[model samples]
Target: MSCPHVTAIAAYVKSFHPDWSPAAIKSSIMTTAMPMNNSNQVLKDFAYGAGHVDPLKAINPGLILDLSEDDYVNLLCDIGYETPTVRKISGDNSTCPSLSARSLLKDINYPSIIYQIQLMQPFVANFTRTVTNVGFANSTYKASVMKGSNININVVPQVLSFRSLGEKQSISVNIARGKFSEPTVISSPLIWTDGEHSMRIPIIIDVTQT
Candidate 1:
């Protein structure tokens, strides 16, 4: 039901931005999605990832986190895939680099963030993301985080200014575990707004004892 609807929306978005990559299209849909349900309650990531898709907003997402084929190859290599296996998967002579999967995962430029940590342990996770400007040139976006009480989240440089279309900006988010009573999943939204457009991405932290 939702799958077909989302697929149609993706197609609709792709029709408008023919040059956008699949990852860019996905980011557009996810970032522009509605965060609340009809009942006016906030949607959970486990149930409604990135909330409901909005086709009209998806057409112009303002900024998109785009990924290239090389990015996929790099991810595979970082995940410990053998050189031969990666080459076969990429259908090219792609080689593996000596990179850590943990580090690569944080920098993948995906529209969402998820981290798992031990319940009683001191935890700090950092992620870096880059977004490309697709909206108005000379626009400035401010970063804000809606975090849970059990963690502290910080975004560096807090502001992004794009001078021209296709310009790219990178930001780093650092999360540290705070006092908590028990193991739980903390859900937050890291949003970048330019007064006109709001780009939201979910940041999920899983705290487990085991």
Candidate 2:
């Protein structure tokens, strides 16, 4: 015989609600999820031939944004970002990983620091702006690199690998009547092996530290 049905259980299930929000829930699971943490003791662990967690590694994970570029520029420098007149400080560990600028503006704009580099070589082939949140909504301040020159650049990493998270796809600019060319932003940790050189766009993450 089948067991008796529990009305209360059914009622509870019907009343149950979803936690947090859909956007937040989606954010928790994405291609760019931030690192999570455990106990504080995790950080104090010693490092040698060892598997030990550290104090810093044990703290709660915060939000983060990664910046990259093909050409050198101040695209990530001195840029400012805030919430509708309410300037919230960046995280406590704001850092500039590359030699380029140590910071990015909350708002992405034109003539980016990266674009400035194209100036060094007016004879560019094709200029592509793969990242650099330029022309995006202010709510999502982004950084971008601008390029202009006359030269051919059929190099490594192709035109497709800058960043997938940024809105408004990358664009290519032709100066010498469509000859010179290069991508605007390049994903960091990129390997430029074929007569190619990678320029690390400097950036300062976690502004709170500043």
TM-score of each: 0.91, 0.19
Question: Cα deviation of 77 in candidate 2 (Å)?
Answer: 4.6
lDDT, residue 58, candidate 1: 92
Considering only N, C-alpha and C atoms within 3 Å, which residue pairs clash in candidate 1? none
Q: Write the per-residue lDDT of candidate 1 for residues 1-210, one digit (tens) a residue.
A: 998998899899999999988899999999999876524323347667888788999998899999977788888877778889998999988777665533376788899999878766787888999899999999999998874445789998799999999999888999987545567666878999999888998888877787
For model 2, residues 121-204, the per-residue Cα lDDT tens digits are: 344334343332211133222223223322222322233332323344443433222312442322111111112212222211
What residue runs in model 2 are displaced by over 4 Å at the alpha carbon?
A: 1-91, 100-122, 130-167, 177-210
Instruction: Give candidate 2's error at residue 143 in angstroms.
Output: 22
